[model samples]
Target: MSENGGRRSQAQRDAITVEIGYALFSGAFAAAVVFGAFAGPALLFELPGGLETLLLRTGLVVAPVLFVARVVSVLLRFRQSPQPSQPGRTSPDS
Candidate 1:
């Protein structure tokens, strides 16, 4: 293949990698929200607090946990995968 064609293919592959990584991360967050929302009541009951508790109680803990996990997974993917030398398809450095 010509250099230009190879470059384009590489760019497409890199873009796909980044997009799939993001999708997985987003799915994790969505799952966390749904899990925390439904399980919040029961889970919160386990916590020692009165009825004054707000949604933040559940979200605060769950959001960070989920976000951290997503970030870590995405980072891992970038680290494990070798990126192609293509323009406009740079993977995250960190």
Candidate 2:
């Protein structure tokens, strides 16, 4: 019996893909909050009462899109990668 405990599966790879997506979302959301609170004034045109509405709104809308973009990039990378295969091996059935 193999140490795999059973047949190996791609569940591990799928789970990692999901985790990366979540991480991207979290990081973008955090960045939005930080920028809106601290750096928004400098990065955006000065507004009334020293507030930058455009930066805040832009962050709220863009964060999720950025998260999706990151996920797409990861999936593309996964597709482009080559899988390791046994050399000089062929099934008897073939």
Candidate 3:
């Protein structure tokens, strides 16, 4: 155990921050892509107003669900991964 007891080191905190940013960026990107895919035909073609509205509405609902799922999956994977050895640490095999 370290002197800080259960507290994470600065490097650990930095890793978490980076992971969080990565998750958010990727989630937003996924959401945008999903929305574009769903509503692109409506936007590009001359669809009826009702159909266009339906497509847009479906996209609006689906995008956020994807965003949340993306974020959760990424963060969960990051959390489950093994942490790297700290600086100046030696493995037992060494």
Worst 10 residues of 3 by lDDT: 82-91
Candidate closest to the true structure, highest lDDT:
3
Which residue pairs in candidate 3 have backbone atoms (N, alpha carbon, C) closer than 3 angstroms, thus clashing? none
Q: Which segments of model 3 are wrong by more than 4 Å?
A: 1-3, 86-94
Tens digits of per-residue lDDT for model 3, 9-51: 8888898899999999999999999999989989999999999
Question: Model 1: how far is 73 from its true place, Å?
Answer: 20
TM-score for each model:
0.41, 0.44, 0.83
> Per-prediction count of colliding residue pairs?
0, 0, 0
Q: What is the C-alpha lDDT of each candidate?
A: 0.65, 0.62, 0.92
Model 2, 3-92: lDDT tens digits are: 489654576566566767776776677656655655466466666643565556666677666656666676667556654454477656
In candidate 3, position 78 carries an lDDT of 95
Model 1 alpha-carbon miss at residue 88, Å: 11
| TM-score, cand. 3 | 0.83
Give me the candidate number with maximum TM-score.
3
